[model samples]
Structure formats: C-alpha cells, structure tokens
Target: MVHNCVFSFKLSSAREGIRSEKVRELIPDMLSSYTVNIAYHANNPDVGMALEKDAGRYKLFNSDVGLFITLAFKDKKYTENIIYNKLLSDKLDVNLGYVYENVVAQMLIAKGNNLFYYTMESKTSNHLYEIDFLTSVKDKICPLEVKSGNYRTHKSLDVFCNKFSNRICNKYVVHTKAYKWENGIYYIPVYMIPFL
Candidate 1:
C-alpha cells in the first residue's frame, strides 16, 4: 500500500494571544494518518540532528516560534540551481538564505514527486520572481510561497491566487506559525503543513 505521511512540530505557545485549542486538537488527528514522531527542540538534540541529517525526508511545520516539520523527499535539478544562485547573491542575508533554503528543502521533501520549481517570465516585467515551487495534487496545480515571518501578506501569493483561483482550489502561505484561513486563502503555519 502507498502511505501518505506527515511529520508535525509545534512552534508557538499561543495563537493571537489565546491558547491554541485548534493546534492542540488537530495535532493528534494529524498524527493518526502517518507514523507519528514528536520532539521538542528545547530539550532534544536528536531531533535537530535527525532533521539536519535527513532534512530531505520530512515536511516542516512551525507553531509560531521556530522550525517545525522537516520534510523528506528528493530534489529537482532546476530548483537546486535556483537555490544555489540565491545563495551566491549578495542580496540575501544569512538568515534569509536559511529561510529560503529550508523552505525549498521542505517543499522538495513534501511534494518532490509532483512539483517543480521554475522561473516564468512575467508579461509586465522583464525581471523574474523565482517561481519557487509547483505541484499537482488531485490534478490541480498548487503554487507555494515560502516565507519566514508570521505575517501572511504576500504579493506573489496574491498574484497566483487571483490568476488561478478557478483552476486552483487553494494556495498556501507556508510560514513560521499556525494555520488560519482568511479571504479563501489557506494561511498554513509551517508546523501544521502537509495536512491540506
């Protein structure tokens, strides 16, 4: 049998100032479909070591504070090149580079089988926004925006949502917090990822 799996991590103590009841409730159910593995980074070196060692095999989720699920999968050739180029560019700082690397790495792990990261020419601008990742789930193409902060306002996500709203059921804003839905877009906290 083919088993679809997810590994989750908690990154926050509360959501919007209240204790996260949804996070508490959803975590156990999220674990039910996959082989569950849990760890707290505060006390566990093993979890960090494991994540770093096989970073390609897990999907990362963040509660609110830190890195969550570490996704497992294979890397595509073109995406690897984009990541490499970004790393060499003086524009991205170390923290930003880490965020991009981790996001791309997690994406490779979660949707490696179906997605490709590419750059597409925008009709309005000669410059390109590195088309980060693409995957077809249930025959619909899903585009993802990888960002580090909890804030969800993103121009790329908005563009993708508007352009493909009919064809795409959902667009993801993967970040370092818990999931929420606003204006039909799914704001997925990195900790609660691969569930949708």
Candidate 2:
C-alpha cells in the first residue's frame, strides 16, 4: 500500500511542472475526494456557508500538517545530516506560514469545527485585510489572526473588529506569545487553541 501510494506520485509532471490550467481542472476531483479541504469566508452573514459554493475563491489546506511539512521539505534526503539538522533546529531558511496555518486548520477540525476565514479589501489603501481563521462560538464569530515571531501588529484583526464588532465574540492573536488578555483581544499560545 505504501509503495503504491508513493508510486502514484511517480510522474515527473508534478505541481510545479504542470500548467496551471490543468491544475485548475483537477481541483474539483481533489476537493471531492478529500485529498484537500476548502475553507470558506466566515465573515459572510451565513457564517462562511455562503450557499453558493465557490471552489475557485476558496483556500486549500493540506489534510495534515505533518504530511505537508514532509512534502514541502523533501527536496533532500531526511537522513542527510545538514538539511535535517537545520530543519530540526529552526535554522533553515524557509517560509512556513502555510504550514502554521495548516496546523490551525487541523486543530480546529479536530475540535468539531469546520474551517472558515475572512478577507476584505482595505478602504484606506490598496492593501487587504485577512483573518487567518474564524470560528463560531455561541453564535458570535471569533476572529483569529496568525502571526510569526516577527509580526509587527495585528492590523487585520483590528480592522475586522471595527467593521463587525457587533457580531464578534472574541478577538485572538495566535502567535508565540504567552497567554494574556489586553485591549479586548486574547493573545494565546498556539497550544491553547483547542480550548478556544
């Protein structure tokens, strides 16, 4: 079974090698077959179930974080000491924001939650506001903005709350910070998400 699964990916024409049109054509099958998941926009009035399913506008998440990590960094042998050590020691230069977001999706799903997120165009500038993950608790939408160790501010969360404060239950910033509540937002360590 393992060999067959590995062999299934034996084709040289993988994601990077394929034309985008062909990849777009395969999305429906990938979605329906549970090979990937689509997270809708939770800020919608229907709480992310927008009634009209738009796969094209959805965000795709890997089924599991571990698999994503392995596949993303498998350009070299795992047994190769240099590459493995850098990854293990956090010294490797890689943009892994997607992996962090994937784990959030997985954790939320494990807690009997369907994945949802929010995005909006900023009025003051050409920039956009994006809330990483949103969950419904007691009929109020809780907005979560994920940040790396070097994030400057939770600007997206602030803007999102300003627009939809009436419908909000909690504002959270998920980062490497310790747990605290200040300025009406909870700054929680990532491990505390299941309790959210």
Candidate 3:
C-alpha cells in the first residue's frame, strides 16, 4: 500500500533502520504499482552534480494529486472519506506536511519535472542539510522546502543555496503562507506550486 511505502521511505530517508524484509520488499512493489497505475515513477537524484552509478537514492510520487489524496486515507475505512473534506476546508488538526509534500511532488511531475532532492551527508555527526525538491531551469538547479506552518527557519535551503549558489537559480519555501519575498527565499502559498 502507498501508506506503507510513504512510511518506509520516510524511515529510510531519515536514516532509521528498517528491520523487516516484508517492509523492504513493499517499497519497490509500491513503486511499480504507482507506475502501472500511471500515477508516477521513481526519481533518483545524484548526491552531487554528477550522476552516480547507484539508483538506490530515490523518491517516489503520485502523478495524480487526486489519487494521492485518496491514497493517504486508504487504511481507515471510516476516516478515509472524512479526511478529504476536512483537509480541503483546512479543518484537519493533524500534521499535513506529508500531504503537502505529495501535492508538490505531483505538481512537479505534472509539469514534466523529475522529482529530485538534495541532502548533504555529515561525516562526524548525523546532521544533514536536506532540500525537499530540486528542479532544473535555465541550466541551474532550484531548491525548494515544504512546510505546513509559518515557522520560517529554512537552514537546509539556506545552506544548500549558499554552497551551490553558482549552480542554483532560485530558492523557495512553500507553505500555507501567502506570497512574500524575504532574504532571497520566496515564500509562496501551496496552491501556487504549479505556477512555480
């Protein structure tokens, strides 16, 4: 199921160990399922500018936003239908970052952009700088960070753009906030993702 894939992906990407073989196998199977359903395909961005030989580093998305919305609540028979209406009306108390991330991924996919993200590995510590999404425009990469709230500390996006300034076109923080320009990062509303 897509929920399991999302959980597994989040765990692995967060550097948490997945001990179950069944859980490991479900990830690829979910990828294939999404592809077969014409929803989305896997995207693997290289750790650096140059392409890496390994395809292990990747992200999966739902190409259809509607399908993704439905997939999010597939587990609960009673609550599944309720979430859709509540989420649309901004009534849900639960954290909506995963939903927003999925929609952003869907929008990027619809725009014909491959879903890619950047993360810097730390040698001495577990700390890492992670950009939520990356897109190429005019020969430069644009880094985006998705947030569910107005809390505006974007250290990852800042560090990434700073280190890769010459290779970056723009920096963005997508959230529920209205449009604003601050310290070079554009804070845009979630609905405006397609226009970006």
Of the candidates shown, which would achieve the greatest TM-score relative to the real structure? 2
Model 1: how far residue 115 lies from native, Å:
3.4
Top candidate (lDDT)? 2
**After superposing candidate 2, which stretches have Cα over 4 Å from the reference?**
1-34, 43-54, 77-89
Write one digit per residue (lDDT tens) for candidate 1, span 33-132: 4333222121111112332322122332332212222222114322444444654463433345235435444544554332233333467988544334
Distance from true position, residue 196, model 2, in Å?
Answer: 1.2
lDDT of 1 at 83: 48
Residue 103's lDDT in candidate 3: 79
lDDT of each prediction vs. the true structure? 0.44, 0.69, 0.65
Worst 10 residues of 2 by lDDT: 1-10
Of candidates 3 and 1, the better by TM-score: 3
Q: After superposition, how far is residue 61 of candidate 3 from its true place, in Å?
A: 1.9
Which pairs clash in the backbone of model 2? none
lDDT of 2 by residue, 27-136 (tens): 67986786676576544723544453343445767776767777777776563567657765767787656766777777787787876666789988999687887887
| Model 3 local distance difference test score | 0.65
| Candidate 1 TM-score over all chains jointly | 0.44
TM-score against native, each model: 0.44, 0.76, 0.72
